[model samples]
Target: MAASRTIEDIINSDTDNEGDFEGFSSESDISVCSDLSDNDSESESEVDQPRNDEWTKRFTPITVNDFTCESGTKLPDSFDVNSASPLDYFWLLFSMELFVEIARNTNRYAKWRMDQTGTVDPYWTETTPNEIRAFIGMEIIMGINQLPDTMMYWSKNPLIGNAGIQDIMTANRYQKVRQYFHVSDREKEPARGHRDYDRLYKVRPILDHVTVSFLLNYNVGRELAVDEAMIRYSGKLSFRQYMPAKPIKRGIKVWMACDSNSSYLSRFQVYLGRSAVGVEHGLGFNVVSGLTNNIHGTYRHVYFDNFFTSIPLLEHLYENGLYGCGTVRVNRRGFPTELKKPKEIKNRGESMVMQKGDSNLIATVWKDKRLVHHLSTLNQPDDIQPAQRRVGPTVLQLQQPASVKSYNKYMGGVDQHDQLRMNYTVGRNSKKWWRYLFWFLVNCSIVNAFIMYKETSKRPRNKKRYTHIDFRIELAQGLISGYTGRKRKASEIDCIPLVDSQNVSGHINGKLSGPKGRCRYHLKTLGVRRETVYGCTVCRVHLCRDGCHARFHNL
Candidate 1:
C-alpha cells in the first residue's frame, strides 16, 4: 500500500505541465524536435516543425532507438594501493612497466636522432632509467614553479633565491631531456602501414598505455560528461581547430569523457581531420557512444553541451540504460519548436515545460535575461527546484526547473578538467604536434593521481592535505630522491686532482693550512671555488693540465 500511495501521491501532485490530464496515457508523449513524425497518423503542423531545414540537414538525425549493447566482464576495482607511500601515487599511476617502455622508446629515438644529426655527447651515449627519472623530475619542478627565459639560466643562477635546479642537476642534463624526449619507438614498430594509419602514430604507444592505465585505475561515479578540450598549439597541422570561444583558439582538439564530480578523464579521442571516417552516426553521437562504451548499461547520467546534445543521442543513451541531460540548440533535430520561438519579456523568471507521450522525455524553457532550453531523459516535466539568485544587490530565492539545474550542475565537469590541466600544465611549446598530446596525457595522469590521493586519504580535518601545487612539488622531490639514484651532481665529476707540488703537500693531502683561499688548479677544473686554504695567485699555485684543463677547453 505504501508503494501504491507513493505512486498515487506523485500522480496527484502538481506538475509544470499546466494541468494534469486524468485520462491521458503516460506513453502518449512527444519529444521536442526539429523534425516531426509519428508511427501513427499524427502529422505535426508546419508551426511545430523548424522554420528551415538547412540547420537540421547538417546533422544526420537518428530516428530510431534500436541501440543494443553486449555485456562484458566487469573490471577489477581499484583500492588504496598508495596509502603507505606518497610516492606511490606516481608509481601507481605511471607503473614501472609503463615507465620502462617510455624510457626504451625515448632512448631508441634519441640515439636515432643523434645519429642522423651527427651530434654526439658522452653523457648522451646511452640514456639510463635514473636519468629518465631525473628528466621527469625536472619537468615536474618546472610545472610547480616559473621557468627562466633560457634553459641554461636554471643552472647558472640561483633562480629559486637560495638554490637552483643545478643544485640537483646540471642544466645540460635538463636540456638533453627536453631535446630528445620521444614517446614512440619509430624503428622497432614502424608507424607506416599500421591499422591506425599514421593518425596518432607519433605518440600512439604512450597514448594507448596511459589511457589504459587511467581507465583501469579509477572508478567513475554515477554522473559523467563528454566534452572537447583544446591543447594550445600553433602548428601547421591538418587537424588543428580554430575555436574562438576557447582560450587557446588555435590548437589541437580532443574529444574527452570524464567523471562529473572529480573531472577524471576516463577516455579520450584525438580528432584527426579527414582521417576520422569510421563513425556511422554523427560525431556527437559517436563520441558519446564510444566514450561510454565501457560503462554501457551502468545507468550513469552523461551530460554535455548543445554541440553534442540531440534527441537521437539522448534516445541512444536511454536505450542503453544511460541517462543524458544537456542544453539543446534550437536548430538541432528533435528540438521543440515552441521553445525556439521568440518571446517578449513578460517577467524576470517565467518558464515552460513540455513532455513526450508514453515516454519520460522532458524539455524545459526558462526565461531570465533570455530564453534557455534544456533536454533530458532523467527529469520530470513538473520537477521544480529553488536556487539562490542575485537581484540588484540582494540574493533572493528563485525557482528553477530540475533539468536546467541538473544540466548546469554536471555540464562543467570537462571545463573543470581543462582548468586544472592548464593551471600547472606540464606542456611546453614544441615543434612536434604530438608533444602537445604527450604532455596532455601527463597532465591528465597527474590530475587523476591527485584525485585518487584525495579519495583514499583518511587524514583528520586538521591534518594538512596535499594541494595540486603541493602534489607537483612532492612528486618532483620524490622522483629525484627515489628514482634518480645519483647521490651527487654531475658537477662533482669536474672536481680537481692534486698536482702533488713540493710546497703544497698539506693541500695535496686535502687539508687546509690557514685562512681559506681559491686554488688556481681547482679554479680551472671546478670553474669557481672559495672554501679551502690553498695558494693564491701571489704564491703561483700549479694548475693541472691533462685531466682538468684539457677536458675544460675541449668541453
Candidate 2:
C-alpha cells in the first residue's frame, strides 16, 4: 500500500502516470461510505500506526436530526410589491428621526462654515426635511444624468443642464454639505486608543445606521453567500485593497452576505486593515463567522469561494447549526489523507468521494477538464445533477455533483449585487476617501429601495415598472417641488421698492425721495440709474416696493 498524497501534490505534480483504460485508469476512485474506519483495512500497517490518527482525532461532525429549507424547495422569483412606493422604502430605511438628525448636522455645519468664511449668510439655510429630501433626490438624479466635467458643467451644459438645480441648491451648498456631513458629533467619538476606533470613526453613524437598517428590513433566503466588493476609490487610505482581478482593482474592500435567490444584501463588514475590531481566526473565518452570526442556529446554508473556505471553518459552521459548501484548496490541513491519494481520472465525468468520521461531511473530487474539489456538509457524494459544459465551443451536458452545482448557482449573489449597483452607480471621483463610502451607502440604499419596490409593487408582471432613471427623476421632482421658499424666476428684477423706503421712515407723504438707482435685472452695467427710494438686500437694486419684491421671487 502507498501513502495517500494531498490534492495539492496531485495537482502540482508532473507525473506521467496514465490510466489503463484506453489511456486512463480509475485509481482515484474511492467509495464515500458512512464510515472511514472500514477503509483503513486497505492500509495493512494499521496495527503498527498510533492508536489515534489525524482523521479520527479531527472532524467530529455532529449528526443533525432534521434538515429543511426555510423558504421551501423553490425560491421566489420575485417579491410581492404591494402598495408601497419608493418614498415608503426610502423612509423605512432612512427614518424621520434620521432626517431630523441630518437637518441638525447640516445646520451646525452651516453655522461653522459661516463663521469660517466670514460670509454674511450661511451657504445653506437651516435645511428642512423637504430640502434634505430634495438634496438626496438631486444626488440620485445626478447619478442617472451624470456630466463629464465638474459639477459646474451641470449649470453650463444646455442640453442636459438644469439651471434650476443650481439655483435651488447651489454648488457651494453641495460642497459645504459634503465637507461637513456628520452622522456623529466629533466630541463624542470613542477614544483613538481603542482597537476599532479608526474604522468606527471613518464609518460615521449615518453609514452604520443605514447598513443596519438594510439588514433589519430584509429577510434572507435559506441559501446565503458571502463575498467581497471593491468600492472604487483612488485616495490614500489605511485599509485600501488592491486586487488585480477586480475591475476596480484599487479601493476599499467590503465583505458582504446576501440572499442567493433574490440577491438582496443581508449584512456587511468593511475590511479595515489588521487592526479591525473583533477579528478572529484568519480574515476568511472572521468574515464568514461575523456575517453569519445572526443566522446561527438556523438551517441556512452558506456558500463561498475557495478564498474563504477551510475544513475548520466548515466544521464550526456545522457546530453552529448552519451548513456550508465551497471549493477547498487541496493544501488546507485536516482534509482526509486517503481522499488525497494520487490516482488517474479515467474520463471527464468520472468522480471519487471520501467521507471522514461519522459525520455527513464529505469531499468529492470530480475530474473534468481539470480536477475540481468541493466540500459540503449538506450534499452527498452520490447526489449528482445535470449541468452544461463548454467543450471547444460546443456545449455538452455533463453530470455534476450537487455540491458543485449548488456552489456555482449561489456563489455569485454578491456579484449580482455588484452588477445591479454598478448599473446606475452614484459614485464619482473625489478627493475625500469618505466620499467613496458615502456614495457606496447611497448606491446600496437605492438598490435596496429598488428591490423593496419590486417586491411590494402590486402591478402586473407584464406591466411596465419604473426604471432606475424614472425612479430617480420622480424623487428629484418631488424634493424640488416640495421646497417652501419663494422660487426665483427669470422675470424678477433685483430692485428695492420705492414704497418700502418711504414706509420704513414713516415719511410717506405721497412723495419719493432717495438716491438714484436702476433695476439690476434690466441692465448688465451699473452705470445707468433711475429714481428709486427702496433697495433689495441681495440684489442691491432700487425699484417699486410690492411689484419688484413679488416679481423677483414669483416670476
Candidate 3:
C-alpha cells in the first residue's frame, strides 16, 4: 500500500520531482486517475508534497474588475461630453482625421492615437458631418483656440466634412478654397464685372499663401507658412488655347507685405501670368482695377516690385490716396529724366546725369489716329519741391555669395563673353532678358524681404542689431558656400572703394579676386558687382576722367 495524497500534494510532487517520474517503470502503479479515488490516498499525497510556507501564505487571490474607490465613484461610460465643446469635437475630428492620414502614410499617428484612446476609429467615420467636420477640418488646417465651451460648440455647428477636407487642411488649402469660393461666381458675372471680381478676389488667396509662405521670415515658430506660391493649369487643350477658353492654362503669382512685428500678411496681390511682368496682361490689369475699386480708403504706402511699379499704376494708386515704394524699371514711364538711359547705363559704371527737370519718360502706344503713353498724373507739378527722398536705396543690390551659391542652379552663370557681348545678347532679346531678370529679382527680393521680416520679428526684449550689410553678408555666404563649395574670403576686394566729390578714386586693388573675379559670379552675387561697378566713382564709365571728352555731368 502507498500513502494517501491530496491534489495539491500530487501537483507539488509532480512539479518538484518532474524528472524523477521520467523513469517510473510500473505503468499500472502510476495510474494518476486511479490513485486519486480515496480520501486516505489524497491525505497521504498532501503529507508528502513539498511546500514553501512563506510563499504560500503571501500568495493571495487578486480579483480585478472595473476599479472603484471607497466613495463608489467610477469612470463615466462615455467621453467627457460636458468638458468638450462643439469646437473641441470639431477640432478633435479634424485633428484625428489628419492624424489618421499621417498615420496611414507613416504610421506615426496611428500608434499615438491607439495608445491615447485604446480604440481605432477610421477618419471617414468621424468626419462625416458638415458642422462638426468643417470646424474640425479648419482646426486641423488652421488651429484651435481656448474659449468658453458653449461658444466653441456653437461656432462649430456650421462646419461641414467632405472628401476635400484632406486637401483643405493642407498649408496650400487657402488658395484652393478661395478658388472654389470664387470660380463659380466669376463664371456667372458679366465679363466686365467678372474681371473686377477676379481682381479683388485675388487679394485673399494671395494673403493666405503669402502669410504661410513667409512664416519662416516672421519666425512664426512653425514650417507651416507658405512663402512662394505658383498655380499652373493643365487640361486637354491645344497649345494655343485663348483666354476664357475651356482647358485654358493659367498661372498666378503672389507677393505679400506683412505687419513689421506681427508677421501677419497685411497686403498682397495676385499676378496672372508666367512672370510678374505678365501682370501687364489684360487679366492682370483687370485684377488691379478690381482691387482698386474694393479698397475702402487711402493707404500710406503701396509697396510692390518693379513689375507693377509703372507710372500709370503708381498714378492710379496715388489717385486712391496711396503712396508707393517699389522697384521700377529704369525705363519705366515717369522715371526722372535725370536718370541715365538704359543703353548708356548697361554694363557701365554708375554716374548721375542732369536732364531737363520737366522731361519725364512716359509709356507711349499708338492707336489708329492717336498716340498714347502711360504717364504719372501724381508727379508733383515741377514747381513743387520734390517730396521727401525715397527712403531705401534706389539701386538694386547684387546677390550675396551665399545667395548666389544657393540660387545658381536657377540663375545660370554669366556668359563668358565680355560685358559688351553680354549687353548685346540681353539687349537683342530684351523681352526674354527682362522676363528672366524680373523673376530672378523677385526671388532675391523675397529673400531680402524674409531677412528683413525675421529681423523685425524678434522679441522686443531680446532684439539684436540687424542691418542691410549683415543681410548681404549672410546671403552672400549662403550662396557662395552653397553653390560652389567655396566661401567669400576676407579681402580688400570685398570692400567698396571710396571716391571723392568727383566720384573718382585710384584703383586700390589691381583686380577683384574670389567670386568678384569671376564674371559669371558678378551677375549672380548680390551687392557686390552692382555696388562695386555701379557705385565706383573712379571707373572710366562712371565719373569723367581728367582728359576724357565725354560730356561732364552733375547731380
Which candidate model has the greater TM-score, 2 or 3?
A: 2
Q: Could you tell me which 10 consecutive residues in candidate 1 have the lowest summed lDDT?
A: 53-62
For every candidate, C-alpha RMSD to the true structure in Å: 11.6, 13.2, 40.3
Ranking by lDDT: 1, 2, 3
Which is the winner by lDDT between candidate 1 and candidate 3?
Answer: 1
For residues 1-555, write the lDDT of model 3, one tens digit per residue.
012233224223422121332211112222232577798978765554323121111122211112111110112245354442222322211223332332232233333445567876443222222322232233222212223331232232335322222222322332222222211122223454454454333123222333223322222111011122222223321221234432224333443343322233323444443444544533423444443332212232233334455656644544543333333455654455434242333321222222112221122111111211222222221211211223266643221111111122211111111111111111011122122222222233333343333433332322276443333333323322222111332232334443333332343312232222222223343233332222232332322123121223321
Whole-model Cα lDDT of every candidate shown, in order: 0.65, 0.64, 0.29
Candidate 3, residue 431: lDDT: 20
Each prediction's TM-score against the native?
0.74, 0.71, 0.26
For model 3 the TM-score comes to: 0.26
Residues 110-216, candidate 1, lDDT per residue (tens digit)?
88887888987677645666667666776767776656554644543444431445555555665667777776776756455766567687787667666666655
Q: Which stretches of candidate 3 lie over 4 Å from their true place?
A: 1-228, 232-263, 267-299, 330-555
**CA error at residue 139 for candidate 3, angstroms:** 11
* lDDT accuracy of residue 429 in candidate 2: 70
Q: By the TM-score metric, which is better: model 1 or model 3?
A: 1
